[model samples]
Target: MRSGYSELLGSMRPTSTNAVVAGEADPSEVIEVSVILRRANPIDVSRRRSVLTREQLTERHGAQDNDVQAVSAFAASNSLSVVKVSQGTRTIRLSGTVGQFANAFDTTIVNLDEQGAVSRALSGPIFIPEALNGVVVAVLGLDTRRVARSHVQLVQSQNVLSSFYATQIRDLYHFPPDLRGDRQTIAILEFGGGYQSADFATYFHQEGLGAQPSVEWVSVDGNMNVPGSVDDTEVALDVEVAGSVAPLADIVVYFAPWSELGWIHAISMAVMESPVLPTVVSVSWGWPETLWGDMAISAIDAALADAVALGITVCISSGDWGSNDGTSGQTTEYPASSPHALACGGTVLQSDGVNILDEVGWPGSGGGISAMFPPPPWQNFGYSGRAVPDVAANAVHYKIHFDGADAVVNGTSAVAPLYAGLIALCAESMLGSHGAGFLNFTIYEDFSAQSTFRDITAGSNGGYSAQPGYDLVTGWGSPNGAALLDVLETLSFAQVQLQLS
Candidate 1:
């Protein structure tokens, strides 16, 4: 073990396999890092029904003043400048030169180039002084390598066999009528690419959605919506699918860089910082658990758990790389692997224009047991590790418009927004006083909610096969929206009665 430090802050190796040592980082170059601090009070997700407001959370669970002071003192002693401190997310920002940061953290800074893209990386674990050992959770932005990948696959123009409009899928799923997600907000996180307003207008107009959903943009860490990039398809797919399904719900797209820091920043903005907090948050970008640092995974998972405690439902795509998640063994993806998140898988739909014919687990749907997290209280499948996905939807052959051109898209990325819109719709009616905090608990625990899914018992995604009850390939299968709404309404009534009693 390395000496001279009170504690080691986990490993900080590069995630990319293609990364190669380019050179030493410039010592004089200045950079800003986000230091995540531990919460004053631990969050209890079981009590998610008791939703807390931003103010309430700040008062109860925000960073302790002493911790912030300790971090500030440490920064001052190390010649680092304090940028900004957020008590809500417990993130402290500090700026310093590469050499200064290296000396402060007790690590070497080196440049790594993966293919043509370059980024700085840490050679080993991060170290902290004894005074700040438990106060600091993670120090992000030191190694700015690309972290997650967008799980979007586009079908070629000529190879497209069939496509369904987003609204059609909603209809086929039997979504409750007359609930247009009014007063509900859906937050979508984008690491890169952007959407064009014209495409939204044209696509909605073509879908016969009477009015386009109100769309907004929030930039985090200097990242903005820049069109024409490779990720445009992922961005456009999420917006169009979610917007078309919940035409009146406000959709806020948060653009951040593709790093662990950016991921946390975007999530914090949606869960803790947004002026209009979202009812549901959708994530279409992530990688397998093996690709992420253990502490980094814990940090993101903590934020997701906070979202649950705040009554915000989070939906994450399990990934598009099948049960192995692009790795050699059967593994699950992070964020999805986080038990607090509703992990969404993929399915192939074979339907007539008006009625459903059949749906099966997509060959590329990501699923299986998580290597990191233990099964949550809601899960009772006799598995030691958390099982994914919690639910699934059609991910093949989506009719979408992006960059002023209509295209066919496929992947589990589309499933996240689809569920986000559906949750928004459900939130409008079922959420009288309490938010739809964690649907997985009810779905897995209640018989009525469990009956709402059209169980998919066919097909496989490598190591796992779809079965009647719940399977690794497709979880509980696709939703019967109206049925689910009815179940939620009943549960809401029961909850209200319990409160009065």
Candidate 2:
């Protein structure tokens, strides 16, 4: 049965033939492909599963010292090293070459039942250094008896709250109503799933934005379809924010798989290829730099450089775990740490009924100097003289309405898209008048310009701290979006004056 299952799974391909080429295909172009894995039966024990508490198993095998010892002895005999023996959870994580012990444990591990027929095995490669997050747990020598296990707790949705104070911060820098007409296109990149149309429509209506903006998905490496089984909470937030700020602009969502190679390919395709060239691309996902090799990092750098050269601004999330990021000490998440992209940090925004009281850097917002890429020429004028968040926005627990659900998720994930929408407005104002060749270059030029940003003078992210003007914690601080638009408009006027002179 395991062999049959493996063969069936291997036959499933996410991509389809005759797919529309991203960054170049028309809006009407449609491609059919498998968007998600079929939901496995909840009781199917043969499929891999996470390790539950021993008390959970003790119901079938009476809770006694002999039973616990027998299980431990059995694991030891099979070369399974106990990674973390948690007495509180009564759960143990084991690591070993699963292929060797397949026959011995295959029938004993059950899914979620009293019957001893199922197995609670995980699927993925097993690695050493037991306590590490995202490690694969495996039985010795059983190729099929493995699971991708990570120690991180999935934050319950109920724990999240609206950081609507960020919205007030955004309101403080309101631009002229006329600026909204300038935005043409804003592109958001997603690796997991698409957004639900109903959720999008409801969000825009509540925001008082008439007629929902057109949203389309650009497929990369296959997997281009509307919202599916994959969690789309992040994607929904991105689309809602971008659409709310720049309703006139068309939103292009680039969907790809979550694999490292797949992401690299999708980004490159989006940069080199999408039908409507986006003025800005917002990315909210990333892993630690240590998890990625030089080659992957270099590939991302190259792709970002290409995007910037094409007059496209790339906004990336700094990460959510602050500096520790589930790792022990100081560490920075990747892609955000990449120098070419505009790294967006987070802020905890507080407000009264009518005005914003304070906006400070979010400590959990990832920011710091990169151990890999050096500071780019454009970042040299900033304060602190280090590599980090080039800018910041209202990302901490911002209120957003998603598909029939109203919830808030905090992280630089929210900030990146928020800024992307702002940039779309900036581009709409400038591109028609000033002919700003590269948006990134324009941002660099404006960093020292007094009216370009609101200087965040407080807060810190573990190793780094924020200061007036510029700092690693919040970069140039959160934007006064309206002020920024005016600045760009003024710059456009100046360019016109120079041309006339």
Instruction: Please give the CA lDDT of all the candidate structures.
Output: 0.88, 0.56
143, model 1: CA deviation in Å?
1.2
lDDT for model 2: 0.56
In angstroms, the error of model 2 at 88 is: 56
Candidate 2 lDDT at 265 equals 52
| RMSD from true fold, candidate 2 | 18.7
| lDDT, residue 42, model 1 | 85
Task: Give the poorly placed runs of model 2, Cα more than 4 Å off.
Answer: 1-169, 181-183, 226-230, 381-386, 433-440, 443-451, 496-501
TM-score of each: 0.97, 0.65
RMSD of every prediction? 1.4, 18.7
Error of 2 at 156 (Å): 7.5
lDDT tens digits, residue span 1-501, model 1: 336476455656535767788889999999999899999998778534587888888878889999999999999999999999999889999999999999998888898888989898887778898777788998898988877899998888688767889999999999877888898899999999998899899999888899789998999999998899889999988999998878889999999998888989999999999998898999999977887887787787888878887888899999999989998788899888898899999999988888889999999999999989988888888997999999999999898888889899889999999999999998987656655667887888898898889899998999999999999989999999989988888888888899899
Model 1 clashing residue pairs (backbone): none
* Poorest lDDT segment (10 consecutive residues) of candidate 2: 33-42
